[model samples]
Target chain A: MISIKNLSFAYKKKPVFDGLNLQFKAGHVYGLLGKNGTGKSSLLRNIAGLLYPQNGSITVNGFTPFERLPVFLEDVFMVPEEFYLPDISVPDFIKHYAPFYPRFNSEKFRNYIAVFEIPADSTLQNMSYGQKKKVLISFALATNARILLMDEPTNGLDIMSKSQFRKILAEALDEEQCIIISTHQVKDLENLIDRITIIDEGKILFDENVETITKKLSFRFAYDAEDVAAAIYSESSLIGNVIVAPNIDGDEGKLDLELLYKAIITNSEKITKLFQQ
Target chain B: MNQFFSLKRFTLLVLKHWADNKKRYGLSVLAFIGLLITWFVFTMLTGFDNIPMGKAVQQITFFLSLFAVGTFYASQYFRDLGSRSKGINFLLVPASAFEKLLCSLLYSVVLFFIVFTTAFYLIDVLMVAIANSLPGTEKLAGKPNVINVFKVIILRFNSDSTINFLLFFFSVQSAFLLGSVYFEKYSFIKTIICGFVAGFILFCMMYFFYEHLLPNGGFHKGFLTSFRVHVDGVNDHLVQVPRWIGEVFRFLIMYGIAPFLWIVTYFRLKEKQV
Candidate 1:
């Protein structure tokens, strides 16, 4: 679990997070969405203790994240947007690095690597970027850290690797784990993240549980002019004008993340008010 | 299991560092040996007639190789921190800052000296043996046992001065290590520039204060020298720095300088950000 309160972070005079408050609880996969330079990855770095907040504090799993004590670090792992794997074989990397995490499951690591299809003896530098990302993802999951922070994890992955990543992440997660993934590719995370938090202009524009979102908001096509006017957010697709409207009834439909993202971004005030109510 | 300083963790960190850099390090060792052998042979062929293959040449070679390789190693040990890829990997490793800093000291200070000394002697002993094996060259060169060569080099700078010299080497090496952390790129060159600029400024300040401002303080190189100031129509006044102050300066040079630089290096590393 992570808690950030009144966190103000900036780059020199350029501010990023201005008194932003956010929390991530265990047993949920969090999708962090934002436009470029909106502080999504910066938020993840703050939670991972990589970057210190200028004001307030970040608490991860009951410990101050920035202290970076071995015990604190053992329970937290971060896959940076731009990451590095040493110039060593995958097995050698694991051999040299895995001991730091007491709960690291070597078996799980091997299984994840098997699913990713990376060669055991191959040097990491020889692998493609996507391949290296897969290796890093596998290693991160195997660490069994209570909190896992990933930035643009699916950026370099092929279509199939992305799907494989979603599957392994879902399978590897436990109730005690909290995974916060910052990415612009929402489709890669469909049916994966349970909670969505969208940030814009150094503030959390939208944060809600996917289940609660589906329960309160209806994502469907507008039937006519009245429906189009009544809809909170809508866009014209090949079939019709798809809309996101308030679901007053108990009817439940599939959550279209991309559409939901647009709805929240456009009608952020109304949507936020609805959630508050 | 100790968080701050664990012997097990330290050992693991050292091994991990080695594993990460063994290829480059091993190759550097080989290259160092080649360079040493080549330089020795070249110097013997070219300069033997003028300089003579005596204790002086041997001492010069030892000190030259020692400093060249030592500074290079110190400058490069933390060079990985310059790039984000390597820097991130290094910083994120689950080791305390103390452990990480200690690991660097172990490699740059201890292991570098031992390994470089061993390599130098190995090459020197073999080369000296080969040179002596020839009929006429036996008298030309000293016998090539590593211990004898060490004695010759050690005798050149007496033991006390040699210890001070090594301490001074550490002070210089510590500055380079700090530079490796200080500058993101071109750490070696940047460190040299910083040192040169700092030296220039210090020299200027010393000239101004000691020569121009300190009551006619033209440096009289004596234990307790007095300066006579022509105080503009007044009687000439004598100003003397006490012997204790001079001893203080000597003590600082002998003992305080390296530790002070090391502390600065530690704080610099501790404050290092990605």
Candidate 2:
């Protein structure tokens, strides 16, 4: 579990977060959505204790993250957007790094790497970027850390690897773990993330569960001009107007994350009002 | 299981650090040995007639290379902290700051000294033997003895110049280590510049205080503790601290500087953000 209260953080003169309060609980994968410079990675870094908050506090599993106690660190693993692995073989990396985590399962690591199709004896430096990222992801998951903070985890992955990433991530989750992924590629996380926290301008624009989002909003193409005009957020496509409007029907529609993200970002007030209601 | 200083965690950290950097370390040591051989061979060919190949050449080579290599090694120890990805990899390792700092001290101070001294002696012995075996050189001058590095003297600056230089080396090396963590880029050069600027500022401050701020008194016997003042007619008054206090201060200056810098380095590491 992580709790952030009135957190204010900045990089030198440029302010990132001001009085931002957020909470992440175990057992759910949180998709942190935001524009390029909206502090999505910064938020994840703050939670991981890589970046210190200028004001207020962040408590992860009853410990101040900035203290970076071994106990706290062993339970939290971060897959940074830009990551570095030592110029060593996979087995050597695991041999040296795995002991640091008490819950590390070597078998699970091997399984994840197998799923990712990365060679066990391959040297990390000699591998391609995607291969390296897969190795890092596999290692991160196998650490079995309670809190896994991933930033742009799918950035370098091929189409198949991205799906493999989603599969392994879904399989890796448990009731005692929390995974917060900050990424711009929302489509890759279609059914993987259970909760969505959209941030814009250092503030939480929308925070909702996938089930609730599907129930509250409808994502569909509208051929009717009136429906397109009345929709909360609509984009004109060649075939029809893709509309994200209030889901008035009782039947739950599938959640379209990309469309939902756009609807929230474009017409946040109406969408937020609908969610509130 | 102790969080702050777990022996298991420390061992793992040391092992992990070694595994991560063993290749680079191996290459660096090899390069150092190669450079030493080249320098010693050059010195033998050019300076054998003028410079004594025994204590003087060995001693000078030992100290000069020690300072140059030692400080550069310490500066590079934490250079990974300069980059965001590497810094995150470093800091997020499951070890306390104390353990990390202790591991750094182990490599930069203890291990570096052992390896450097071994390499120096290895080259020193070979070079000395080659110089002594040279045709007609042994008869023209006394045999060139291989210097026992521990016993070599430099200008009689202290009872044991080796020990003095070793302590000074640690102090300067520790500063460079701190600078490696403190500055993001060009840490070695920045630390040297900062050291020069700080030394100059301290010199000016001391000169101004002694000459203008304080009464007309000049420091004499030992570090700032003994001063002589001149009255118009009376014998120049000599003021000095108690011998015990002066001895303590002296001991601290010689031994405390490295650990002092180490403490600063530790705190800076704790405060380091990436």
Candidate 3:
């Protein structure tokens, strides 16, 4: 579990998060969504203990992340958007790095690399960006870290690899682990993430589970004027007008992440009122 | 496991760092060897024409190269911390900050000095053997023997001077080591510039205090003490600080600088972010 309260951070006077409060629980894949410069990456870094908050406290697994104790580090792993791997073979990287994590599973790591189609004998520096990211993702999962924080893990992956990533991530997650992925690309993780957390201007605009979102709101096309009028948010599309309307009858539908993000950003008050009831 | 210090974790960190930098380090050492061989070949060719170079030439070359390249390697010990990609990987490693800093010190100070000395002597012994074997070189230079290079170098000067020189070298290297962490890019050049600026400032201040402020002072010495007298003859005499103070100054110069800079580097690394 990760808990953050009254968190404030800035870079030479440009405040990123002010009095921001948030929490993350285990056994769930959290999809952290936000527009550019909305502090999504910064928030993840703070939670990972990469950045120090000027004010307030952040605790992960009952340990202060900034302390960076071996006990704390062994349980937390972060895959940043831009990462580095040494110019060594995959097995060599494992030999040197895996011992730090007591629970690291080398067999699982090898299996993950095989599933990702990255050759285990290949030199990391010679591989492409997508291959390296896959390797890092594989290593992070294999570490068996309790909390996994990834920033744009799918950035360099091909379409096929993206789906494979989602599939592998879903299978790799243990019941005790907490995973938080921060990305502006929402659709890539649509089916994988169970919770949607939208942040705007350093504050969480909306945070709820997929079950809660689908339970309270219906996302589909409005065929008529009445349907369009009932939508809390709408946008024109090729088939018809896509709408996000209150599910008064407790109906179920796919959660439109893109539309939900747009709704939360443009019509936050109305959406908040809808969820409040 | 103690968070501040752990022998097991420190050893692991050192091994990991070596694994990550094995290629770069290997290449650097090989390059240094190649450079030494080249210098030896060139010196032999040049000095063979007139005075067949003896131990003095070899010693000069050895010490000069040792100071120049050794300091450079020390300064570049933490170069990976300059880039965000590498810096993150380095900082987020499970080892404590103290371990990380100690790893660099181990590489830059202890390992570097030992390796550099060994390599220098290897080339030196080989070159001297070749020179002694050649015709018409026996009378020009001393007979080649496998001499202990460390002893020869230290014995060139008095023990006190040798100790002082070693201390000064360590202090300068420590400053450059700190610069490796303090500057993001061009650390060597920045350290050089800063070093010159600081030296200039210190020299000017010392000159001002001794020359202008002291009013034409002249040294007056006794058996166990010394004093400086003001030309005005108003008994404005300046007494030298106690012998303990001098001893303390010597101790600081001999032992204080490296660890002090190392501690600074540790704190700097702790506050580092990427």
Candidate 4:
């Protein structure tokens, strides 16, 4: 569980986040959607206690993360976008780092490593970037931390590894743990993330469950460029025109993320009105 | 006991780092040996028989040993910076700033003092024995004994002058530590510039107050007079100032400035975009 209130941050007199507020709870995979240079990583760092917010407060599991007590540290882990492991074997790293985490499950770590096919004898520094990310992810999960913050985790992985990554992440989920993943590749987390939080212009634009999104909006395909007045947002595709229709009829249709994003940006007033109704 | 255990962990980390870069350590050791050999050969060739080798060794050991300390300290700081990929691991550890600072200071300064002193004394004894046995350098050697070296080390520790020297060394080291945390790039140079700029600003403020402000009767002369008297009264035979005040000042400056810099650094280091 996490709470951020009136969190504002600036760099060199330029505002990155202003009065941003949000909350997160356990039992859901959150997709932190945001554009480049939109303070996605900055927000994640603030939550991880890596960087302190210039103004406002952040509480994680009833403790200020910046305090970084042993109990808090043991229950929180962050997988940074750019990471390096010391020139030590996987086993050696575990041996040295595991004792710090009281709930560290060495057996689970070994199992995940085996399942992921990571070499036991390989030094982490010698591994590829994607491989190292996997190793860190596996180790983080094995720590049994209640809160995990990951940034751009699927950036360097190959297609197979990406799918494998998704599978492992899904399998690693539990009712007590909360994972906040910030990434641009929304498609990679299509079915994995249960909730979506979109941040733009230094503020959260939308925060809703995927199921709620599906029930509240309908994506329809049109054959021609007819101005369907009922359509909240419409875009032309090669095969047809894809349109987002308000869910006044109670038609439960699959929510097209790209379409929904376009609708929220281009016709925000209409979308907001529909949600209000 | 907590401090001791934390120190042990710090030592382990440093050893792990050294093990990871054994080649660099080996190169440094070879360079040290080469320097020692050059000094030894130069003394033999010059026929400097009047110079007491023991005293010369002690002097060289004291000064050159600082080089070992300086190099190790600088390298450790740079190495930690270079390990940015793993920076979060070190930064996020559940250790207080004081614990981390003490561990770093002790491992680099105190440990280096112990190890280098012991090893260099042994090397000095061996060199003296070899010089005494050589045909051309018979007068170059004195009584080669460990007791004399131990006496020199013990006497150095007991001397009041040594305490003042250590205080100054520690003060400078504290400044460097603060510098290490202040600037992300070229921290050493930035720290030096910052020190000079701060000192100059303080000097200018004092000069203005004494020259202009005091002339207008804006301040009390008794304050300045008392300050001068206080400073003069603290002057002593061995220490330039009373040891207690010097120690208190050192502790206050180091503890105060180091943590402030560390907190500034914590806020300054942002998460890099990938």
Candidate 5:
């Protein structure tokens, strides 16, 4: 579990995040939704204790992350968008890094690597970017950390690898562990993330469960724009129009992430009010 | 158990770094050996006597060893800052700031001293042995006494002598550490510039206050008079401060600069972007 209170950060005199407060609970996968330059990465880094906020404090599992106590560090892991693995082979990295993570499951790591098709003998530096990310992600999961922070994890992966990534992530989830993933590609995390947290202008706009959202709003196709009545938000495609309408009929429909994202950003107040109702 | 785990983590980190850069470490060792050979050849070609060779070798080795240590420390520190992979991996490890600081300090100070001193002694002994074996090298007959050399080295760090050395060492390290943490880009150069700028600014402030703002301030006169008397006495060949006091004052000054530098570095680190 993680809690951030009134967090504000600045670069030089320019503010990046201000008065941001949010809490995350364990046992669910969280999709951190945001636009470019929305301080998504910065927020992840702050939670990871890699970057210190100019104001506010972040606590992970009741320990201040910035303090970076062993207890806090042992239970948390962050996988960034870009990473480098030393020239050492996978085995060498394991030999050197496994001791630091008390719960490190070497067997699981080996299994995951095999599943991911990462060559054990290949030097990490020699691998492709996606491969390197896979190794890091696999290793991160193997650590059995209580909390995991991932930033743009599927940025450079091929479509197959992205699905493979989702499968691996889904399989890795447990009741005791929480994973917070920040990415612009909501489609990548569709059906995988249980909760969604949207950030814009350095502030969290909404934090709602997928089930709650689907129950309150219905995503349906309308043949004509006129058929969509008092919808929260709608977008037109070649076939028809997709609209988010109030669940007044108490209809439970599949949540449309793309439309929900648009509604949250374009008409956030209306969406927030609808959710409140 | 936790302490043991922490130690294991530290060792793991060091081993990982070594494994990753084994080639670089090997090259550094090879370069040092080459330097040793060059020193021996130069002495032989110049026909320098044993005493001169000993003295020159001692001074050169001392400096060379220091340079080696400084280069390794600076390069590793800066390289980590510049490296995205290494930096992220390092930060990911669940260690306290104190533990991280201790590890860095150990690498810069304790490990460096051990490596440099061992290399210095080994190279010195080998060079001396070769010199003694050469024709017309009778002047190099007397071998360096190991026990005496060690005693000299140990005595140099006595309470009286160690103060100044420690002060200077800490000041330099603090400057480097601050630089490593402050600038996300071009940290090495920025550190140097920041140090110079800080020193210059302090100098100017002192000069202004003493020379223009308060031309006849009694505080300045008293301080300068005491400083002058101290310097004059040390060189007068008559009255001098006791050796112990001199050593202690030297150490105090060196260490005094460390906390201030560390405080600044800490603030800079807190504001780090990455």
Candidate 6:
């Protein structure tokens, strides 16, 4: 579990987060949705102790992350968007790095790599960017760390590999693990993320669960002009006008992540009020 | 399970560092040996008289290479921290700052000294043997012999006291190590420039304090030991600090500097962010 309170961080003169507060609980995959430069990665870095907060504090599993104590580090793992891997074989990497984490599961690591279709003895330096990313993802999951922070994890994966990533991630979770994924490709993680937290300009615009979102909001195409004008958020598509509206009939429609994101960004006040009610 | 210091974690960190850098380390050692051989062969081929690979040559070669290679190696030890990707990898490793600093010292100071000394002596012995066995070498005025490197005194400021060059080398190398953590890019060059600037400032401060602030006197018994001043047509008087104070100062200068720099390096590493 993680708790952030009144956290303020900045890069020199540019402020990233100002009096921001959020909470993350175990047993959930949080989809951190934000436009570019919305402090999503910064938030993840702050939680991981890779960057110091200018003000306030962040506590992960009852420990301050910036202290970077061995015990704290062993329980938290971050798969950064841009990562580095030593120029060695996969086994050698595992041999050297896995010992640092007491909970690392080698069998799970092998299974994950096999699912990713990575060669057992492949040299990391020779692998493509996507392959290297997969290797990192597998290693991150296999660490069995209590808290995992992933930034743009699906950036470089191929189409099928994205599906593989989703499947592996879904299988990797447990009741005690917390995963916070900061990504722009929400569709790649459609069924995987159970909670959505959208941020803009260093503020949380909307934070809700999939069940609540489906229960209160309707996502579908509207053929009638009256439906289109009455919708909270609507966009013209080639087939019809797609819209997101209040779920008055208790229909519990499937959540459209992209449309929901658009709706929040464009008509946040109404959607947020609806959620609050 | 100890957070600050754990033997198991420290050992794992050391082994991991070696695993990641063994190839680079191996190549560096080989390159150093090759350079030493080339320098020695050039000396042996060019000298017409006397012992070409004598004590003087060995000492000069040993100290020069030690300073050059030692500082460069120390400056590069933490270069990974300069890049975002690499810095994340490094700082995220499950080891305390103390353990990380110890690993850096283990590689940069302790192990480096052992390996460098061994490599130097290996080349020095082989090259001296080759030089002494050359035909007509018996006619030389001096005998070619391998020097006891530790006993060599490169800095003899006074007749009664001699400072060990190894201490000076370590102190300077530690400064560069700290520089590697402080500066993000071009750490080696930046550290060297900063060193020169700091040295110049310290020299100026000392010069001004002695020449303008103090009486018309000069330090005759080495630096900071004793001062002799003219007393207006009277017998000159010598002022000196207590023997214990002098000894303490000497101890601090020779041994305290490296450990002091190491402490600063540790704190810098603890506060490092990516």
Return the top candidate by TM-score: 2
Greater TM-score among 4 and 6 belongs to 6
Q: Write the per-residue lDDT of candidate 3 for residues B1-274, one digit (tens) a residue.
A: 7888889888889889889999988898889889988887887788743444466677667668877987798779878789877777877788888888899889988998888888887877887788777798667535545545455555644656555666677788888988988999999889999999999998999778767876566556532245576656776777786878767776776899888988898888787766
Candidate 2 lDDT over residue span A9-91, tens digit each: 99999999999988999999999999999999898888888888999999999999989999999999999998899999999
Candidate No. with top DockQ: 2
> Could you tell me every candidate's TM-score relative to the true structure?
0.91, 0.98, 0.94, 0.79, 0.81, 0.97
Of candidates 5 and 2, the better by lDDT: 2
Candidate 4 lDDT by residue in tens digits, A49-131: 76678899999999887665555777888888887666778877887777666688988887777777898778887898888
- For the second chain, the TM-scores of the candidates in order are 0.83, 0.94, 0.88, 0.56, 0.65, 0.94
Per-residue lDDT tens digits for candidate 6, residues B70-111, read 999999999999999999999999999999999999999999
In model 4, pairs of residues that clash are: none
Question: Fraction of true inter-chain Cα contacts (below 8 Å) kept per model?
Answer: 0.46, 0.83, 0.54, 0.24, 0.69, 0.85
DockQ of each: 0.57, 0.88, 0.67, 0.25, 0.47, 0.86
Against the reference, the lDDT scores of all candidates come to 0.83, 0.90, 0.85, 0.69, 0.74, 0.93
Give residue A114's error in model 5 in angstroms: 1.7
Worst 10 residues of 3 chain A by lDDT: A65-74
Tell the DockQ for candidate 1: 0.57
**Tens digit of lDDT per residue, candidate 3, span A1-277?**
8999999999888998889888899999999998899898888778877788999999999988777777788788999988999999998999999998889999999989999999889999999999999999999999999999999999999999998898899899878999999987889999989998988888888999999999999888888989998788999889999999898889778888888988888899999998899
lDDT of 6 by residue, A1-277 (tens): 8999999999999999999999999999999999999999899989999899999999999999999999999999999999999988999999999999999999999999999999989999999999999999999999999999999999999999999999999999999999999999999998999999998998888889999999999999999999999999999999999999999999788989999999999999999899889
In the predicted model 1, the residue pairs found to clash are: none
lDDT of 6 at A238: 100
DockQ score for candidate 3: 0.67
Q: B199-264, model 2: which lDDT tens digit per residue? A: 999999999988898667678878688988867637778888899999889899899999999999
lDDT of 5 at B102: 55
Q: Report the error of model 2 at residue A25, Å.
A: 1.1
Q: Lowest summed lDDT over 10 consecutive residues: which window, candidate 6 chain B?
A: B155-164
For model 6 chain A, the run of ten residues with the poorest summed lDDT? A199-208
Candidate 6 lDDT (Cα, whole model)? 0.93
Which is superior by lDDT, 2 or 6? 6
DockQ (C-alpha) of model 6?
0.86
